[model samples]
Target: MSLGEAFRTAVYKEPVMVWSLMIYGVGISYAAFVKPSMIEPHSKDLPSAPPSLKEVMAGIQAKLNNK
Candidate 1:
């Protein structure tokens, strides 16, 4: 059979396996070659670290006073 016919038969016989392999291949290629940026805690766009213990107490007290 010709190349197209061979490919059609393969797909017809195991469509699920073929599609799963195709998805896995694309995922692996993306992870290996895309080089996605790493997120840094110190990035300017992110808010600073967690509030201090003192700051938390101050906020609680302010909320109580407001009520």
Candidate 2:
């Protein structure tokens, strides 16, 4: 079944599943909006130029393999 159908089944057929999903959703929403992430505010902390192709390729590979 699709994600939507699975979610609907969880909500309608399983009250515990719905509560668990709601808790998970609230946690995710809180993290996305309420959390303060680390980021450099100064330009000096960043690179002066764009990254090289090697860095780009490595990043892509790492992301695809969940490294």
Candidate 3:
């Protein structure tokens, strides 16, 4: 069988394949229609040391998050 015939036969044989293909197609189409902007880089937006930890941390050194 030709490549096109093989693909058509496989797609018809597997019901899950058909449903999966439809779901994937719809997801790609929705993302294409609602393209979103990218986020800013982490390093670029990193905050500097707070000038006055008094108001923010009650005049104490900020503890590390240790994530």
Candidate 4:
């Protein structure tokens, strides 16, 4: 049988299956259509950029000196 038929059969056999399916569908729909800005704070600070080459070199030098 197809996936739809199997899902219908499961739902019919167990009423609780409907609740789980409804939650799953709602979660998927929200994630699919909702904007990220709407879900989270737009004013939140962005992440810092990665270390520069000079910073990385200094870190390596410090490690070598410590060793």
> Highest TM-score among the candidates is held by which one?
1
By lDDT, who's the top model here?
Answer: 2
Q: Can you write out model 1's per-residue Cα lDDT over 11-49, one digit (the tens) per residue?
A: 998798899989999999877766454444337677668
lDDT (10s digit) by residue, model 2, range 1-67? 9999997888889999888978999999877866645333565687899999999999999999994
Quote model 4's TM-score. 0.41
For each candidate in turn, give its C-alpha RMSD to the true structure in angstroms.
5.8, 14.1, 8.5, 6.8
lDDT of each: 0.83, 0.84, 0.70, 0.83
Model 1 alpha-carbon drift over 4 Å, by segment: 1-13, 26-45
Per-residue lDDT over 2-60 for candidate 3, one digit per residue giving the tens place of the 0 to 100 score: 99997888798878888998999988986776443233445467667646646667434
Give the per-residue lDDT of model 4 (tens digit) for 14-63: 77888888899999888877866475665455546778999999999999
Which ranges in model 4 have alpha carbons more than 4 Å from their true place? 1-9, 35-67
Candidate 4 Cα lDDT to native: 0.83
RMSD of 1: 5.8
**Ranked candidates, highest TM-score first:** 1, 3, 4, 2
TM-score of 3: 0.43
Provide the TM-score for each candidate, comma-separated: 0.45, 0.40, 0.43, 0.41
* Model 2 lDDT at residue 20: 90
